[model samples]
Target: MTDMRVSIAGVKFKNPILVASGTFGFGHEYGKFYDLSELGGICVKGTTLHKRDGNPAPRIAETPSGILNSVGLQNPGVDAFCAEEMPFLKRFDTKIVANISGNTLEEYSELAEKVAAAGVDMIEVNISCPNVKAGGLAFGTSCTSAAAATEAVKNHAGSVPVMVKLSPNVTDITEIARAVEAAGADALSLINTLLGMRIDLKTRRPILKNNTGGLSGPAVLPVAVRMVWQVANAVKLPLLGMGGVASGADAAELMFAGASAVAVGTALFNDPYAPIRVRDELAEYCENAGVARVSELTGGVKPW
Candidate 1:
């Protein structure tokens, strides 16, 4: 039998398939469809220090093979997540990762401290968030901001392992990856949505209220794979690869490219059972290939 288990930053996951943050929404809705324990881990929606209403109407736009979203980190805030959401999540046997975002370095530290004290398995610092303090420049877009965010979270996150989520909207992802690794990030997750826009020809206006939004789905798969491969070789931190993962083959591609584990995101909107399906398919893939352990696929790709 293939051993699907893998450990990242000392946290062992039952399998490599995890529901990406913002897609799983605390796992309460998806839990009704299947047992949440069936999967390896769950990344709760992005949470801030305080509640946020999110972007205005028309925040989603369906593209050719992907979707554009400007959800703007809508959540019940850090206090509410610990007070109300943790109870529901704790009942499950799966690993829970809190995806945290902040407008400033101090806010990131505060959110990390609160969530860490609340007993989460890991904290995913979402530096890809547009830094309001820096006039909307995404924190992940620069080495300085990314390293600062990682350092601040590490200082206040206590013992909970910190994973910095990298944004794809940058010139060199490797530079940012190395920067975070140096700043003391325990792990990394990459290829957050690519910036995109859809305009209505008739109205000559953007479909999403934010005008341009983050693109995610099958359309971004190739880009995700490329970025994962680059970051994997650049840093020693385990990577949580994502950005357009939809099937088992897709998951395998990311794993082979160098992701320690893979995350299913936009696919969840079309199929709620995606995580389980992908896990099963991945098992089948390993069985057919005669691989003893699924983790062996990490960085398995060879040069021509």
Candidate 2:
């Protein structure tokens, strides 16, 4: 039998397939479709320090092969997550990774402390959120700001593994990866939605209410794979790769490119069972390739 288990920063996942944040929404709705324990892990929705109403309506727009969204991190806040959501997620055997975002360093630190103290298996820091203190620049866009955010979370996350999620809007993702690794991040997740937008021809205005939104879907797969490969080479930390993973082959491709694990995002919107299907397909792939273990696929790509 092929071994599907993989470990990131000492946290073991039954497989390499995880549902991305913002798409999975705490795994409540999807849990009704199948046992949440069937997959590797679940990166819960992006939680903030306080409740957010999110951006204005019409926050989503359909593009050619993907969708653009400016949900603005709508969530029930960290306190509510710890008190309410955590208990529901704890019932599942899969790993629970709390994906947290903040507008300030203090907020990030506090969120990390509370979630870690609440007993999450891991913490996925969403640095893509704008740093209010830095004139609204995204923390993940600069090495200094990214490292600073990672350091602040590390100082309070206690023993919980901190995995920093890198944004794709930056010029050099490797620089940001190296910076976070040096700042004590236990692992890294890359290729957060790329900046994009669309406009209505007749109205002569943007489609999404927020004007600009993050693009996610099969459209970003190539970019995600390339970034994962680059960041994998730049840092020693394990990577949880994400972007446009929809099938087993896509998951394998990301793994070959250097992802220790992979996450399914936009695909979930169409098929709630995408994660399970990907996991089964991945197992079949390993069996067909005569590979005895799935972990062996990480960074397995060969350059011509």
Candidate 3:
């Protein structure tokens, strides 16, 4: 039998497949689709210190092989997550990584502190949203902002690990990854949707109500894998690879590319049970290939 377990930041994951934030809304809805205990973890939607109504209607637009979304961080806020969701989440039998996003460093810290109080496995600091005023810009666009935001959260997060999620819109992802590393981030998750747009020829307008949206799906797999490899090489931190992960093969490819663990985002829309399915598939593949541990596949690929 194959050993499918992997450890990141000293925390053990039964498998490396996790559902990315925003794609798997707290796992309560998807729980009806699959057993949450089968997967490694679930990174809940982007939650701010307070609740948000989210963007206007028609926020999701379908592309040729992907989807563009401007959900605008619509969530029940951190407090509700702690009070309403956390109780059930605590009993759900899987690790929960609460994803936090805010407009200021103070907000990020406060959210981290609150989530730390909520008793979760980890905190995923989301600095990629465009709607947020300050923290979003500083944490995602520049090395300064990224490090500052991460450091602020680290200071307040206590024992819970902070995994900074990097935006793919940056020019040199390596610099940003290095900056976060220096900022004391325990791990890194990369390639949050690429900025993209889809226009209607007959209507002469964009498909999404927000005009432009974050593009995610198979169309982004190649680029996402490349960025994961680059950041993995740039930092010693565990890399949570995400982009257009749709299948078990894609999850393995991310591990081969340098992701200690992988996140299934857009693909969840198609298969709500994808997170667990991917894990099972990985174990099967590892057993057939004579691999001892699935984590050994990380960065196992050789360059031509």
lDDT of each: 0.91, 0.91, 0.87
| Tens digits of per-residue lDDT for model 1, 249-290 | 999999999998999989999999899999999999999999
Per-residue CA lDDT of candidate 3, range 160-184, in tens? 9999999988899999999999999
How many Å off is the CA of 42 in candidate 1? 0.6
Candidate 1, position 128, lDDT: 78
lDDT of model number 3: 0.87
Off by over 4 Å in 1: 130-137
- In model 3, where do residues sit more than 4 Å from their true spots? 131-134
* Local error of candidate 3 at residue 222 (angstroms): 0.7
Native-to-model Cα distance after best TM-score fit, residue 39 in candidate 1, in Å: 1.3
Clashing residue pairs in candidate 3 are 138-145
